[model samples]
Target: MKGFKFAGIHAGIKKNDQKDLGLIYCEKPSVAAALFTRNKVIAAPVILGKEKIKIGVCRAVLANSGNANCFTGNQGIEDARACSKMVADCLDIEEDHVLVSSTGVIGANLPMDKFKTGVPDVVQQLSEDNVDQFADAILTTDTCRKIVNRSATIDNKKFSIMGIAKGSGMIRPDMATMLAYICTDIHISADDLNKCLSAANEKSFNRITVDGDTSTNDTLMAMASGTSEAQINDAGSKKIFQDMLDDVCFELAKMVVKDGEGATKLAQIIIKGAQTKKDAFKAAEAIAHSNLVKTAIYGEDPNWGRITAAVGRSGAHVVPEKIDLYFDDQALVLKGDWQGTEAEKKTSQIMKNSEITITLDLNLGQETDSFLFCDFSENYVKINADYRS
Candidate 1:
């Protein structure tokens, strides 16, 4: 955090005059690791960033909203390169060391003229105090900025980790549904940092769903400035850094789910007592992505049948007779049978809360998994239907 500067500005990329461009610059080249969307139709920046991240070092990151710069053929790649080069030229750094990201409506070309005129001014406004602005500038439909900070000490040496993310819809977490940038002041190897990021992502971004759609420009990246001089070479120090990183990413991921487009309830689907962790995850993911389950939650209905149907079709190992289901602490189904209208009434009340948990016990083994998701509503449909208009 100490060696980084942030900036956000309205570069005319967005028609509403909102801040659409953001920058994060480190005083020196920092060790970097990144994860990108698994979707084959990726944005130009995602393609370029993946190649540049292979070197494990970066000096700055430039991100823009309001244009995904995808499906534009070779011109999209040229525009992405031009944007990165402009940032490199303004900051006197190598173009390869400057990474780029973009989000918003897909299949659009980037406005190079905006970058040609605004890059210098945006660079001039960079400061350590502008992190909030940078967070806001990366958003598309996100109602609020998601930022988190955590610290840890190892061997009497202190380190700081900070992250910012933006997501509201088109979130299914194939690799992070939206853009997130993390900065740390600890010294660590790029390989170690990558391992830490992947582990953290599995429990955080990879476990959340909103609309079940993976965007073309999903990315999550981390950089270590090594300004703290706290070396994380040994196993003990690495564990400490990884734990702190996981907490930050988890909190940001929760924020993304909480701010899901037109979502009023945040629900956690837990699948337990499975034959394998993979089976549990499969079942939980199915329940999380089911529109029927989501709408039932939105309407405060204890629709246990929809949940069971989703789990049964999930392809996970399951014994219908051994299943048990609960809404929060109230039982809706016991031993694979509906608990009657009285139990359904209680579960309905529980679903009325802003946050609720739906637990399913397979009664097969000890393996368990869970996913964070949100309720579906008519507003979600409206928001996406007219998003570009």
Candidate 2:
């Protein structure tokens, strides 16, 4: 966390005077790597940041919420560029050294006048203790800010990794309307950092789902300041750094799901004994994305039929008679046959908990995969319906 400064302020981008702008700056240019949304309709900041990050060096990250800065054509791109330039000029850094990100409703333009007046003040207020404020500023519908810290010691050298993320809805496996900024004090190359970020992301962001929607503004960026004196140039040291980074990202991802809009329960769908790992993930994703299954979980109903039906249509190779299901270790179905009313009663009780695991086994092969998701509730519908209001 050292060598990094953060600032968050109300830049008039949101209507309620909430903090809508956040800045993360390093003492010097740092090795940077990033991943953006896979959505075809990408946002303006994403288009610009994608090119800047390819240079593998960055000194600052500027983000805003409440206006997505998407679909406004050339003006949106110019606005993103102008914002980056403002931050760069204020901080005495190159415009290309700054990465920009925005999240909120689609089809709205960024209010450049706000950034024109606010970026300088934000730069002046940057402090190491304001990370919580930055985290809050990046949120749109998220109920709480997600921040995670991790440290690792390798060969007597200590390294710190801190990550902040914001998300509540429009979530899916390919990423969500989420924005994650990760900063570390370790010394590592951009290539190695990218490898670590991608690998960590696969097990974290890529496995979480809220409403099965991938946002156009989804992004996860990582920067290493090289302040720890720990050179992660070897396999063993790289593994240590990767593991710590993975832990930070995984914790943040879980926070996003736990704070999912109108979410009452966090469920882990574990698929095992599939014909292949891909098939396992397919079945898990299908079950996790099922509205019927999510609503049943919300209502504490042990609807095994919905689960099996989702898996059957997931295109995953499975023998119906060889399937088994469990709700938090309580068997609901054995070899594709219902265990009856008593089992359902116990499974329903399991669903009452804030967190539960749904495990499915296809007695067909040995590959497996898992996904983290949340239950759907009436409030979710209400939240989206009144989002713009």
- For candidate 1, the per-residue lDDT at 369 reads 95
Q: How many clashes (backbone atoms < 3 Å, residues ≥3 apart in a chain or on different chains) does model 2 have?
A: 0
lDDT of 2 by residue, 1-389 (tens): 79999999998889998899999999999999999999999999999989999999999999999999989899999999999999999999999999999999899888888999989988988999999989988989998899999887989988899989999999997853379999999999999999999999999999999999999999999999998888897899999998999899999999999999999999999999999988999999999999999999999999899999999999999898999999998999999899999999988888889999999999899899998999999999999998988
- TM-score, structure 1 vs. true: 0.99
In candidate 2, which residue ranges exceed 4 Å CA deviation? none
Top candidate when judged by lDDT against the true structure? 1
CA-lDDT, candidates in order: 0.94, 0.93
- Each candidate structure's TM-score, on Cα atoms with residue i matched to residue i, is 0.99, 0.99
Q: What does the lDDT read for residue 152 in candidate 2?
A: 76
Residues 1-389 of candidate 1 have per-residue lDDT tens digits of 69999999999999898899999999999999999999999899999999999999999999999999999899999999999999999999999999999999888889888988878988999999999989988999999988998988888888999999999999996998689999999999999999999999999999999999999999999999999968897898999998999999999999999999999999999999999988999999999999999999999988899999999999999999999999989988888888898998888789889999999999999999999999999999999999999
Count of clashing residue pairs in every prediction: 0, 0
| lDDT (Cα) of model 2 | 0.93
